[model samples]
Target: MFETVLKCTKCGKEYSLASGIYKCEKCGAPLDVQYDYDSIRDLIEDNDSWFREPPRVWKYWMFYPVSNLRKIVSLNEGGTRLYRMKNLEKKLGFGKLYVKNEGENPTGAFKDRGSSVEITKALEFHAKKVVVASTGNMAASVSAYGSKAGLEVTIVVPEGTPIGKLVQAVVYGAKIKIHGSTYDESLAESERMAREEGYYLTGNYHYRVEGQKSTGFEIFDQLRFDSPDWIVVPIGAGTHLRAIWKAAKEFYELGLIEKLPKIAGAQIEGYDAIVRAWKERKPITPIKEKKPTVASAIAVKAPVDGENVIKAIDESEGYLGAVTNEETMEAGMMLGKEGLFVEPSSATALALAKTMREEGIIDKDESVVIVATGHGLKDIKTWESFIKL
Candidate 1:
């Protein structure tokens, strides 16, 4: 088992493993799940053979902070396919393009990976009820996993959540609460509900970030345990970006990888808080009123973990960029042409990649891995426009 601690990313303060706290008491910044790397290295050395087994994320069980395997409520969330886009590479003239399709997850999005671990942690803490706020994907993931464990589930969603993901949460029997116009408002309500109603809030928790780190683990494994030059992902709350960076650092410390890959984040035009903060070289200020865009999933008015996200980008020598709604839809259509249909937010990765390549920010010789975070089926209504063509 790992000796884990919840450490604040900003203030470097540590909390007990069983503290059940999500943020730092001192600074309010997001906490990271830090492990005893030396112990982890020793374990890997002792059980070297078992590391090659299947079921991707679980293969890295020693990396997770959970003390009891019995408490893990998994739906085989990780181990998604890594697709080599040779045709895309030729078309875009980029070096070694690939797509890590997280849409293959049971709930049709990458949020399942985090929700699986978060729900398990809630069960471990003996919580009877759990709550989450999401644009759509996280709500659905939590609802499904929470229902499987027979825990009461309550979800807060913004008014315009995509119909398909909303339907998933409903069918999973979660009591849905419709909140403010933006995802940020819903999250605010969820936080209040957690404090007053004593519901175990799971979204944006440190353990959830640990679970999402499995995507980085899977990408490394799929690439034969080598580091790519760039790993692009769509940014919402920005936890996934930080999680990927955490996994890479863990791999580097364990001597599994020589260096960390650049962690680039893509956001749609209207929901680019992290990008704006990065460009300004200042703290993030939440957008008061967000504009409408097809990329509903990543349309967060405020990213709670914005500071950590900026730190990850800076530490990894990465950049954050945004694309217009037209560009997002165009990228989604291009993926559809490749027989890979993904949500608009997921397509933003490709949109960023294309932009970087055209602007000469991305070298033609460097390998690139784009993360398609959700399935197009989750936002099937958006695909009707592409179908009309």
Candidate 2:
């Protein structure tokens, strides 16, 4: 009811919330969902009261893009715990280190956040089915939501997509399509299907991004409206990073919070798209590539929003960090040792933070929150080495 609709990030052109247009052809850039701040201000004035109403992410529905609450398909996701790293912080020698554990969501990862809104929007578009090319987690998420919405789900995964992700997707009753040798190939095939067919694209949909951004909103809420000094997020498709940065900016613009937090992105070295753009020292390039990574979920060769990811880092005064597969797995094991079980993709952010801290790139006293993007169960294949046979 309080929707202000979609606005192109580059051209400022506005479209109706129900328009179903995801990008701006006028400026050839991504579009973002905007809201009526006046209405949001009134609805979320007493944020604590809103939290008392629901144990899910939709509690912030007043600020998101969904028009009909009835169309929402959720797995009771988006209320993940923000963990205070005690011994791990002590071991890392950090004064204040925290992690937003996103694996606890209904389908076992953060993808549920975006997938929930995506399915709702698809229903709004009267879509009979939804489709996606996933490294693993997104496919499973789409399938779960599609099942709940009584729609079909088509999923494309890389040939080597880990066993757990494939199982999850199949269990949710998706038509699994295995494709090329890498994640990028599958993403391309999925996009082509959506373009040629009528299935709605969920991963990069503006509304999907709007829903995922609520994680950032919840992070602030969990912190009692205090923006952390630094936020390190795992960058796969750039949606999570882009959404968080957008949400923080909105919060600041709406006078709900003060300043935006410096948002750093973590990428595995083998499949670093945003990293290449950040290091180029040129105008941001078209996100393109062959996906590669041991932490397979974040292994994207090219993400659609490379420029936006770099811009978010620049605007927030943060830098890019890449971790090796070995480091990521170690970080995952370390997280488990700390009693936080998160997938390796999530570990990438924490691993890079550890690397940065040791390299003197990051100061110890700074307040930081690492975004653990998925649960460990999604990538259980990597756990055997670290956990001992």
Q: What is the C-alpha RMSD of each candidate to the true structure, in Å?
A: 1.6, 2.5
Cα lDDT for residue 102, candidate 2: 90
Q: How accurate is candidate 1 locally (lDDT)?
A: 0.86
Q: Indicate the TM-score of model 1.
A: 0.96
Candidate 2 global TM-score: 0.91
- Residue 217 of model 1, lDDT score: 89
Query: Which ten-residue region of model 2 has the weakest summed lDDT?
Result: 283-292
Q: Which candidate's lDDT is highest?
A: 1
Q: Please write out the lDDT profile of model 2 over residues 59-144, one tens digit for every residue.
A: 77776766788767877888788889988888997768999999888888888888888888888789997788775778888899
In model 1, residue pairs whose N, Cα or C atoms come closer than 3 Å (at least 3 residues apart or on different chains), thus clashing, are none
- Model 2 Cα displacement at 192 (Å)? 4.1
All candidates: TM-score: 0.96, 0.91
- Residue runs of model 2 more than 4 Å from their true location after superposition: 11-13, 46-48, 51-55, 158-164, 178-185, 283-292, 385-388
Error of 1 at 266 (Å): 0.6
